[model samples]
Target chain A: MSAGDDVAVVGVGIHVFGRHDGVTGLEMGAIAARRALADAGITWQDVDFAAGGSDAAGNADTSVSILGLTGVPFINVKNGCATGGSALTTAHAMLVSGAADLALVVGFDKHPRGAFNPLPEDWGIGSWYGETGLMLTTQFFALKIRRYMEEHGITESTLAKVAAKAFANGARNENAWRRTPLSEQEILSSRMVNHPLTQYMFCSPGEGAVALVLARSRRIRELARVPVYLRSVAFRTRRFGSFEVFSPSIPIESAPSATTEAAAAAFEEAGIGPGDVDVAQIQDTESGAEVMHLAETGLCEHGEQESLIQSGGTELHGRLPINTDGGCLACGEPIGASGLRQVHEVVLQMRGDAGERQVAKHCRVGFTQVYGAPGVSACTVLTV
Target chain B: MTKTRQFRLIDPELIGGTEQVPRLIGSVCAGCGTVTFPRQRSCPRCTSEDVQPRELAIRGELWSWTIQCFAPKAPPYLPGGVEEFEPYGVGYVELPGEVRVEARLTESDPERLRIGMSMELTLIPVPGASDTLTFAFRPVEEDE
Candidate 1:
């Protein structure tokens, strides 16, 4: 009889995104964990189960030495961008099964500068794919968006508008990386890293860390004020015919993206539809992703983004505010931490703790999604 | 008579057929009729191992496209430094009943590319290694 309401996120913590010269990813992760423990009004010694990981950063369990050797059964996750969501999924299952009363989940990563350079053999493709310069993730996004624009009447203007809104929202959130807002015109005119997508539209690989503390039902009623309930968490990989990152080719037939499937499953498990979500934080790996994911997640209809984005419907004060903390576009996507960052932002918005960039409308339910490499996605539905 | 030499392909397993009219080599699933570029041993759709090698259509329509306006890093990438790199076009060409093969386009200008345009496969030397040949597609000339 366990449901999403059975476990609650009592506390959340984040290390400022973007680069930090001397701080290592593990250090940032430990800092975020300590902050979350403090926010939950408890100590690390109180945690019984723990899970965390990073992409390029060191192993997550090594933090036990830094946070006191409490002998907490800690697990490490390394599922690319979905690392955060996977960790949360594990912690949630443990709490729901009565295996643990209190659990902590942390995600963090530190990637070097420039677009991520994934190896061909790593993705099961020949070296020719990368040797010929077709392995860039940016190229895939540009190609997808370019075709989407042609098919759905999405103009380049709408693409720039998405990035403009992201930076504008980032300007208000002090923790965001690209805090300076740029106009749509400026964004469109920025150096073209890929045709139809400018340099400003993409999120660079950066450094950051985020952590959350979960308390089962009984403890939430006793110790927490305004606990955001973890309604449902869903994770999925690409099915055949679905286009994903690092592919030499794709089938002529089309299928729903991993995000689409995961979002649907999440909403169904939570017993909440897309219409009930007042605010959301979707994977804005690029501006086009925000546009495509908006419809893919069922928040809107296909081809509806053309008008919704142009009219400022996705802004902080708009009808349905998206990426309230600027998302991956402005947050710089730390891979492991990006997914948790979305949940962290949603948790803040739901609790009315989001300072200046809070959504204007009263919000009860929040949705977050993270989609990444080789066709993987993780979605969550949270309610206050 | 001029001495003709054969071109060395970047990956012989990918591009096959005569050097003058190269065609992409893909695999077709005998069970479910699924096709994949660069070939695979099993069907991604039905999980059948009865896949056969097949020569794909040399001509198709541009499904989607982009331009690589920056230099990719080395190691996996074989291109030259940023200064020597030239922006190139990349896209997926849909082969009607077959699969969409992602390849480089000879054209670099975005204005010159359009969706659904006729594209024919061609071979060009790998950017850094002049002696190595790789596959690409170029817009089919109307006159031809």
Candidate 2:
């Protein structure tokens, strides 16, 4: 995509992420969508199209149904945890293609009651096993952590520091699910969910919704609103069956193709490089994944994440503040909405409206990433 | 009077196809050298409808593994309750034909697992349950 057809994010909104005892997924999406429309100084009638994402099949329909209530045509997208990023990408494409002048993208999910298992009945490789039982998401990431540690000489204590930092940041986010700060001692003392990974090291699965309003750059300028342009949005899946052969212990670095491909495409579109990113929000289902993403996102070199964390480079006052809105570790993962939440934070930081949790100085550009299971990844670079 | 336990609802496809043997289904693209496990009508690599069904090799090596000690937050699946097992190990098994499948490992002990260990696929009954079976990996000794 070229800058000529670039779309700009004019407004963003999100419901506080946490357990909501009474609200359904539809209500959450509607609430965020309304807030986004208001923030953009427009009404629901102004939306030319709508896009949504949800992990729960039921929730996807609910989101689409809610958007229809606004009298706008909508499409539902599902890409596992990357659903939100995928939704935004779809909205951007529609605007750039002239399918719509104004579009809304929303994502939301309600935590499931029990273990999260990939439905094997769905036509996919996961369904082949007649009844081998459900596999927990933690197990897949735990294996990656174990492998990373063995290969990179990383220790559990190092990973705990990331959790601790996220918890501290979470305490500053009024919308975060886990508002309490965790000390290194607390994070270290937490019960183990997977060896080397404790309870606090993982993001909580909660109910949440995020919405964004996007328009063609020309329209944004005409509307007299600060334009947060979508410089580049790229989605790439790993070569099937390559995950196992490629350093499972340090897969993030080994699968440089996915990250680099997305980054190159995005940067090329943005007319910038890694050095130009003032802030970033990377996908980290677990603390270990955050460390790995630091390297994969090019914020630091491989095997240098631990030192980067030790140097406090990712802190709010650090050179390049990351996940300043607490991240999944603190804000909780709403699956479908998590990716959008990352972008929302970046937009807020860029606009200097992040409240108490705001990063020092102004941020002009930021990057967000999200990964889907069975090996799919998406990255988007945004600039104000 | 007869007493019966409530059975969980499961997809019939998972109850084993008519063949009575669990088969890992995937799609191989004729236009490009790409294989998609669990079958796709259109090839992901080449985006061509010229795809055919291919069965994945059941046996593979253990690429990596981990034990789950926490409860998951989704549906149709239950974590080990207070009365059941608290934790279990799962691993990504790399099949001979280059498919990476996730499954429960028969080896519950973490210390016993090695990254490159040889493993074979097997269909076994769910622990403490009957009539329902799931796929898992069984360590293969050199002699076997």
Candidate 3:
């Protein structure tokens, strides 16, 4: 492959994540796609390949009825929280293979209030497991973080700090759902959803959409003035003995989480070290997720979060800003859209277009990670 | 005197011992010796078909824990409504030399729960349905 065989994100768009009263998920996706196309200074007919997905929303390809059916090869992806990542991976491969000059990948989702009520049969668990009140993603996160805290000397204050920082950033992001910055005390004292995690600390399942227009390296300069190079994209699933969501039991032996593996692989492929990342967007399903992922993604040491977070190292102006768009914590997690949202935020930050919430550092390299149910993770590295 | 009728477990395949000393039903792989709860037909580690049903240990130490303060949505969660729900303890108890099992704990107060504390397998009424029983792990008393 030539040096110009790589792919880059030329444009991006988003349908403000949170409650959308009358709009369907498909309509949001079509809207985002059109916005991304406009940002790229191109029309839908110019796209040669497309891919997208949503968890509870309709098939991604069905958005064509709204976006105008140009007969694009729109592949549908459904990898839980990694839905957007999987779509990007597919498009990246297609572009690198010389099959497509331009690609449009979108992800959108609309979930009902409260936690996701997934079926036991759908996840290979017996009904008894769910009936016993052990089927909650919140409980799993709480349990994992509880153990991690005990082992790593992480405090409840640190957990609250993560959520507070998310809101602080969200307040600056016009499209974010929870725009009001909350104090760490407020976050800590909020109604406890799961022990050690309060209402303010966990992100609610909500609705939104995001789209990205990618192009072959050679076409990036022509399509956009400041294209964010898609350095690498990696996805991985759980290995045996790893703790994950929806488990009745875990093996005695332990292994690295999917996020750990995917992050390592993405960094390796991008030839970028964790220390070099000026900005990042890791999954923050809850405060604990962000804390553990900070270490798992090799961004920091396992126990360093206590000091890193407490000292404001994760703030937008800090040494390494994380989730500058407020992440799932403030924007709310629209499963399919959440992953793509991370990438979109990185692209905006790299292009100096993140507005009020942009990183203070000169961000040359940015990283994004999305982890989800059934132990799946997707990581990406982007450069200006 | 009238005798009390015995309550049935949530699922027969999950537990397999007398009421006084109930044990979780698990499958041990003949190929890799990996033990899985609720008895799988194949080994998760080696994908071996030579898996056999085995009654897991009844005692273990709490590995990790949390309290579920909100009631889960119904359909998948066959339990009480939001108004009738009470916060409950949830945790993973690691059986010695065996797998760590996730279960509801009898204790909901965080002050009373700690990792590495001794826990014993027991049965509790499935919330909202006292007629049906489900497995749980309760802190072991000092005298017992």
lDDT score, candidate 2, position A304: 80
What does candidate 2's lDDT look like per residue over A80-187, in tens digits?
788988888888888989889899899998976433555544524333232333435676678777777777767777888888878888898888888888888899
TM-score to native of every candidate shown: 0.98, 0.80, 0.98
In model 2, which regions exceed 4 Å deviation? A1-4, A57-71, A126-130, A244-260, B1-62, B70-83, B93-103, B111-125, B130-144
Tens-digit per-residue lDDT, B1-144, candidate 2: 011333332233333322233565566789984665546689766689999877666677887777767544323243323235557677777776555666678887878888778887665555444444556678899778
Name the TM-score of candidate 1: 0.98
Per-residue CA lDDT of model 1 for A37-146, tens digit only, reads: 88888889889999998999999999898999988999999898899999999998898888998999999999999989889998889999988889899999999888
**Worst lDDT 10-window in candidate 2 chain A:** A244-253
**What order do candidates take by lDDT, descending?**
3, 1, 2
**Best-first order by DockQ:** 1, 3, 2
Query: Candidate 3 overall Cα lDDT vs. reference?
Result: 0.92
Q: Candidate 2 docking: what grade?
A: incorrect
The best candidate in terms of DockQ: 1
Worst 10 residues of 1 chain A by lDDT: A1-10
| Candidate 3 residue-wise lDDT, B64-104, digit = tens | 99999988888677647344788999999999998999999
Positional deviation of A307 in candidate 1, in angstroms? 1.3
Q: List the residue pairs that clash in candidate 1.
A: none
